[model samples]
Target: MTTPPHHPARRNLLRVAAAGAVSAAGLAAATPAWGRTTAAPASPPPGLSDPVQRGDLVVDVRDHGAVGDGVADDTAAIQAALDEGRGRTVYIPPGTYPVSTMLTVFGGTTVLATATTVIRRTDGPSIVGNGVLGDMTATGFDGESDIVIQGGVWDVNASNVALNGNGFSFSHGRNIRVYDVRVRDVQGWHAMELNAVETVRVVNCRFEGFSDPQGNRQYSEAVHMDYAGGPGHFTLFGAPDFYGCKDVEVSGCYAGPSADFPSYPRLVGSHGGPDGHQHTGLRVVSNYADQCTEWAVRLYDWLDGVVQGNQIVGGGGGIQIGPAGVQTGGNVVVSGNTLRGLAGVQEAAGRPPDAAICVGRLNNARTHRLTVADNVVEGVAMEGISVYRTDGCVVSGNVVEDCEGAGIRLHDAPRAVVTSNAVARTGGESIVVADASNAALVAQNRADDATAAGVRVTGTVAEVVVRGNVVRGDAAYGIAIGAGATGTWHTGNDLRGGYTTGPVDDQGSGSLTDPAGVA
Candidate 1:
């Protein structure tokens, strides 16, 4: 084994040209030409020098003895290439490379690939940026910066690996960019997981076919980012799970699950530390989600974020905010999205049925200052939008149609405004202010074609004003005030196409200034 002479960058091009003939001859001739004989050597190929550079030191894996034949395990050859590409660009040409082990990517290294290049992972994660490695550690920030992974196709085989798996595992990095990549057929855990990361942006990526064909014993998603175990490890694996990340954004991506599998693509705030770092400063915008098990966009204990302009379809629910028990997440905006065909659970009796959008706590007031506006929800299983036990929230200019439950309901939410919206074809009441909700203004809205009533003010509510609305076409009562409703002011509403039972059935003693002549 002889080492090459120390040559300058210009000599690198000549070496590449000289190696072309030897590479074309055969893998047999490659032994002496580059001074390598074995397929899986104990160390790197003998006489291999530092990666050659043209301008920015482009380390082509082919020059480093990678066959990329899809049958042979190219893990060792690719690993050696990555070692040479520590501070440079690692270029993968158009070929399918089979990997049986993980590829560690150090910081300041760009793993760029052509669209025709495919990295097929038979076992374990395809690429890992920061994690446990021997007794040493690489935090992706240990004197490094700007780790970019762009433009490749990753195929993950769930049947061949453990339950906790991923295509790209990037943790404890800053300014990480994963863009324009395609991940296909991820079966076990997640496609991408970002743990304890800051200032990361994921843009214009595509993920498809996330499921467990064996059974639903394990949950899987497309992308997960969070603070789970350590910054370099996992407590629980979720697709794009965001537990304690800050200043993250996911934009212009697609999360599509298999038709047979029930899984979510975007999961935020799934894991946390005992100190409770609240997963803040996130944005999910301009994405498309299909066939999710639960909410298309699920947020738990997240703060200071915006979920806008996303098209979510064929899921258990559309968007969900807040967590169970006493956990609260607030100061979020959900606007300008199309949520349709949600609520995957129709008859399964255990968990409460899902809604198009749900905010705040289920049993108490925990979240605040949430604005849900200008969204469209159709064919929702339960309520289109429910503000439960939250304060200072605004639900305005939204449209709900063909829902199984109430179009919009404010359950014990105080100081809320439901204005300028349209509700139609609801299975229950079109709009409801119930459960001790106080200081509510349900004004300038239109409700029609309800199985129950157009607007129902029930429960022990106070300081309620329902004014300047249109209620029409109900089989039962148009506006039914339950006997428990009190301190209600209902006025300036046009009640037309009187109910089958009666136009207005006001059982409560609330003040009413309407022309319907109901006592």
Candidate 2:
């Protein structure tokens, strides 16, 4: 499946087009395999009247001495039904089935449900799909393929302990697909837990109402994917610990904690990627995340991912890249998202006022070649978008407005581009490049009604270019090149009738060639 170097963009376009189809055929076709094959159901299974008879396999939980009454424990009968459903389709009729224990889906089986179907987790962990094969003596790599879990409403009654319960847990598998499922009231760690998996496609799912009964929101997550051992290792957990997964996609889903409670819901996160085995090739698109106390989307030590076309609201931060001692892998793209009102969301302990979109390093770790474009970040408490200690990044075509602090700030970022952005009514500087930033381009941006300077270059910056920008209604200097800054070039800006401290104040030894036209 190798295409030409010029063909990647075209291929991505086709894949995105194919991913939006509502049919299983379209999903199977659009999805690319990391290490295994995926064969979608060619046609919908026969009606839900009789036992599902596919070839020699037949599974009817009712025929296995099971009752779907909401009182009885049907775990043994349903487990027997699943055992009979190996290599076939296991069908559950539309009723309230009380499962007292975990039900495992063997390899090559499908669970299809009707509109009124419900699986209630009464005890033990919810559901486990073990895709690992063999003794697993080595460091990485395991088994199982083509495991599909789709179309059911799995519910846990907000039980308040983190023992082993997860709505669905799948690990050590390739080409695993979960489609059109809804999970609610999960009382454990996460709604869905995926670890050490490759080529996972979770589409059109709804996960809601994650809670901690002990009043500790730190452990609750909607979808957790971590605990990757080595490449292809078959590891699993109920909470996310992204260690070594690759080629993962979580698309077209609605995920949140409680709609009523202001709590910390780790919407999605990846923790430790050990031994330099970075979790890579992730795609998170077209999802809705709401009321998160932590970030709606976050990554640590991750590389080569795309977070696009999402509607994220009321989170600690809308999307957070590497933070504090985590060195991120390169070429991450964040675009086409609508993120609003993160400053008023519930904050976790030791967390500061959050940004709508941010890429930074708190310790010695660094981020490179990141792209933040075409996003709308408004009504935030701090900077709308901040790039700190990152190199070779691009901040373009974004609308950042009505923030309590600077609209866009670049600190210690070298060789970066900040272009074609709109910043308005910020409490601090609209755009700032400071702390030894060099060789940066600040071009074609517009700033208005800023409480501080429109564009401020300070802290010993060098070789910076400020060109073709428009600044109006700023409270302080329109373009301020502070003292001790050198090698600055200010040219062709439009700054008239708005600055209280006057325009184009050059305190440095750089050239300002457009004094009359700009100031």
Candidate 3:
């Protein structure tokens, strides 16, 4: 919940919006009040045995007294069909069914339908959830497996209402697949709340429409990867479980606003992890996120994840990796993403300070062994790539331009290698090695038309080497070293183009420079 003071984030930020009010962070946007008070079953009911006694592989909802009309309440009929269709496919024909109650998903549940089969919910909890509460044991997550919920449009029509209702909430399961499902208009909550689950794949789904709840819910995610750490957390009410997500993949998905609703505040991330636990094997790739309030993808306290090939536009930030709510976890690779116009999204939400790609929370959180490479960040208001408090990071082969702040900045990060980057038209310095960033290397970079210097090293930093970099256009200087900065070496740099000030302003202590090639 902490960030660099320059990058104003969604911990406790209050900003205006183009659609509605921008709420605060940590909204606690769980499901309805009934989900909070209902005593969840410890296990599946005894009657939920193999329902194929009638010698059928599929159960149709129309045969179970479900009128396909939009006025009839099809809650009981759908539940009856699903209850009888365990270990089978429960099919619903093309129609609009008004569901007013929560539907339970069994272990072997496979609910299939066409794209026209819509389950429009009223003011209620999640439309579908597993009917099991957690026991907080070591073997709690080994409960359910082999479930599939696919090929339908679930509209959680939360317009003009002040309730917290999600689209689908799954918990304590394994090998779950939720693909080809379109969840629409999820007001005040996440489209899918995955709690303590493992091996979940959310593919080719369209999560449309996510607005704030009645209270503060600005940081609400569309697909929330949550921990089942009991109540007062991201779980759907009283689930006395304790496990994080493992092997989750959210790819080829669309996370933006619906035609009738506003965009969600966030998408595809986690925030409620507090113990020494770590979510591992998370892969977020090839998603198109347009015009969100805060960020498109954010992972906190995560270990071994890859966020690549995502196209993000118009959010407060882009992909951010850090250690929040826990200590010592972030070994992530963020690469090949395209982030553009983040300033437009952040200013529309009334806070425009975060970078296109951010690593580590602040100067205090320490992330280890990160790789940020080959990303294209453009038209952002703040820094292009901002890394703070990380150890042994590599920022290479990136293309950054048209940023209001530095193209690439490292703060309190040690042993970082920044190489082979291309930067142009930056308002601040093109590359900055400052704020106690020791033992770093900035080499073979191409910088052009920076309003500030080409390369700047400030604060109490030591052993920073800026070598073999090509500085072009009229910057303030080729290399500017501030006071109190010790042991900086700028060698083999080509500063052929002129600047406002002279090239290599050496004002630091124990700084060495190569002979200038041009004045």
Ranking by TM-score: 3, 2, 1
Candidate 2 lDDT, 349-370, residue by residue in tens: 7666656787773445777789
TM-scores for every predicted model: 0.81, 0.82, 0.85
Query: Candidate 3, overall lDDT?
Result: 0.77
Report every candidate's CA lDDT: 0.70, 0.70, 0.77
Candidate 3 wrong stretches, greater than 4 Å: 1-55, 132-139, 213-215, 235-238, 344-352, 514-519
Clashes of 3: 0
Q: Give the higher-lDDT candidate: 1 or 2.
A: 2
Per-candidate count of clashing residue pairs (backbone under 3 Å) = 12, 6, 0
Residue ranges of candidate 2 with Cα displaced over 4 Å: 1-58, 131-141, 159-164, 229-243, 257-264, 323-327, 344-351, 511-519
Deviation in Å, model 1, residue 381 alpha carbon? 2.8
Candidate 1, RMSD to the unseen true structure = 8.8
C-alpha RMSD of each candidate structure in angstroms: 8.8, 8.3, 13.2
The TM-score of predicted model 2 comes to 0.82
